[model samples]
Target: MSLEKQLNLLKQIDNCFLALNGKKLPSPLGVLDRYLWLHEKAPYSILAQGGEEDPYFIYANNYALSCFKYSLDEILSLPAKLSAAEENRPKRKLLFDKVAREGIVYNYNGDRVDKYQNTFRINDTIVWQLEENDGEVWGQGALFWSKEKERPRLVYRI
Candidate 1:
């Protein structure tokens, strides 16, 4: 895509993000909630949520499902770490640290494995800390597919 087109797409995505963050939507249960809605609307996208035992996937839109060759139920049942190749474990841990300490980060580029363990590149992935109203930390992440052509997007929120 041309730079202009990419910029326009980013603008549209930003608008969607803002709209979702607007008062109409409650504060997300971390990045997962936001990604879940975004992926739903952008069926060509993917979204995953993580937790303690494993990075549980709470959502995966149609496109993501097709890309990974899995149904929604199948994707949700898988762990988020399943997307991380064994060699990338250390990097994933670093990402976890950022989410734990910073509350938010952006433009993270990396590779992720799919349900079948196929690797794909991801760019512009964002991570954000999830907190309760009581100030308790939950988990954090907001990621999307790195492809500029909009082939498919996947997000991991934990």
Candidate 2:
């Protein structure tokens, strides 16, 4: 990643954590840049959309890109709405609006689509808005994953 992109992503992460924890946790210093690598290789996916009128992805970790079957460039080039089916977009927009007001929402459930149009459901999601020191809204991010081992989980619907 370019230094500018990396810094932008880290700023959002830092601000999100700040909002969640009531403090700022500084990024890696000197050579401890592994903090970023850890996020990239996180077990679940991490995704963020920009604050445009029609938001497109601005940040997607390696795990998210892998799960969504898109390259960094491809995912960044697409709008976040494409992740959900047409019918699901309204539901997602509602959640996005709620998060815009609530700072964060937990355990959100939703259906998502991949690059090949494969369908999947996400569970135990945590979605939140990105805010900085001056309370500027950068966008939002989500941590979630497919709710299944096979084609579909069929586990718990609640």
Q: For residues 32-110, what per-residue lDDT tens digits would candidate 1 score against the true structure?
A: 4453454444533435364464667654555566666677677767777776798997898798787677655667778
Candidate 2: misplaced stretches above 4 Å?
1-4, 21-32, 147-158
Note the residue pairs that clash in candidate 2.
none
Residue 96, model 2: Cα distance from true site in angstroms? 0.3
Among the numbered candidates, top TM-score falls to: 2
The per-residue C-alpha lDDT of model 2 at residue 57 equals 91
- Score each candidate by Cα lDDT: 0.55, 0.74
lDDT of 2 at 105: 86
| lDDT score, candidate 1 | 0.55
